[model samples]
Target: MSRGFKKFSKNSYKFFLLIYKTYKLTKKFHEFDRIFKKLYNLLNFVVFSVFLGVGYGKYCIK
Candidate 1:
């Protein structure tokens, strides 16, 4: 009975550790995703502004 209790405790400790590690990884991924989204938006805005400027230049020249 004592042996079984020791094994159970060990397994529970490992399970909790696994859960904690997974939570930390997910948190990091969320942070990376937020930063990536911001960078993507900034890139899109830059591209859009460049195209708008080119189009306006063409209109003015014509």
Candidate 2:
């Protein structure tokens, strides 16, 4: 009985550890996703402004 109880406890501990690690990984992924989105938006804005400037210059030249 004691051995069985020990085995059960060990399994539960391992299960909980796996869950905790998965949670941490998900949290880190979400943070990285947010940062990537922000950088993507900034890049899009820069590209848009550059294109607008080029278009305006061409229009003026023409």
Candidate 3:
């Protein structure tokens, strides 16, 4: 009946999952230093892209 997708919740869910994975990995293994950095970088990229997309949608599209 309604759209299942909303940008805030969807992106925030991705955020939550990234945080959870980072927590779990840190809790389990010190060897995950490289992997943890990768996830952190990925989270930065995701958030950046979301903001960029929002701006593009608002300003560049009709």
Candidate 4:
């Protein structure tokens, strides 16, 4: 192979590696996002319930 073609091939391989890594990282972030959303929703529900119970208890006492 000519020197120019060899250099081009090497650069191409590096670019492919970069693209593959980006795809893997994106997938990982998506999974993390789903988990985070689930936890956030659960926490929100707990907080809402606490507030609601407190409000009802105070109303009943008065």
Candidate 5:
């Protein structure tokens, strides 16, 4: 019985460690995803503004 309990405890500890590591990795992935999305939005906005400026300039010239 003591040996069985020790084995069980060791397995449980390993399982908990795996879960903790997975949680940390997923958290980091979410943070990176958020940063990437923000950067993508900013890039889109800059490109749109540049296009608008060119269009307006062309209209003014005409």
Candidate 6:
């Protein structure tokens, strides 16, 4: 008997939700120019931060 949460799907449900939200927002809104731009910038920052953090950790460990 196991405990805690189990992610049985290859793609977690949250990923699906994120994809759906992004798709819907982009498809439905033409005037959400600034909002979409800000969201894109925020996503870029998160991705860059993850890469930078991992690279710095590897350098420190070596």
lDDT scores for all predictions? 0.66, 0.66, 0.70, 0.66, 0.66, 0.59
Error of 3 at 27 (Å): 12
Q: What TM-score, over all chains together, does every model reach?
A: 0.52, 0.52, 0.49, 0.52, 0.52, 0.49
List model 2 lDDT by residue over 4-36, tens digit each: 655775786577557556755776677766665
C-alpha RMSD values across all candidates: 22.9, 22.9, 5.1, 22.9, 23.3, 7.3
Please estimate how well model 1 matches the true structure, expressed as its whole-model Cα lDDT.
0.66
Off by over 4 Å in 3: 1-29
Report the lDDT tens digits of candidate 3 across residue range 1-62: 11333566577768877876777766566556567668867977887788778778888898
Off by over 4 Å in 5: 1-28
Model 1 error, position 59 (Å): 1.0
| Candidate 2, pairs of clashing residues | none
TM-score of model 4 relative to the true fold? 0.52
Writing each residue's lDDT as its tens digit, candidate 4 over 1-62 gives: 34765577578657755755675577667775666557656855775687678778888988
The sequence of per-residue lDDT tens digits that candidate 6 reaches over residues 1-62 is 01212232224446645765786677566556556557766865775687678778888988
- Collision count for each candidate, in order: 0, 0, 0, 0, 0, 0
State which candidate, 1 or 3, has the greater TM-score.
Answer: 1
lDDT over C-alpha atoms for residue 50 of model 5: 72
**Over the stretch 1-62, how does candidate 5's per-residue lDDT look in tens digits?**
44765577578657755755675577667775666557656855775687678778888988
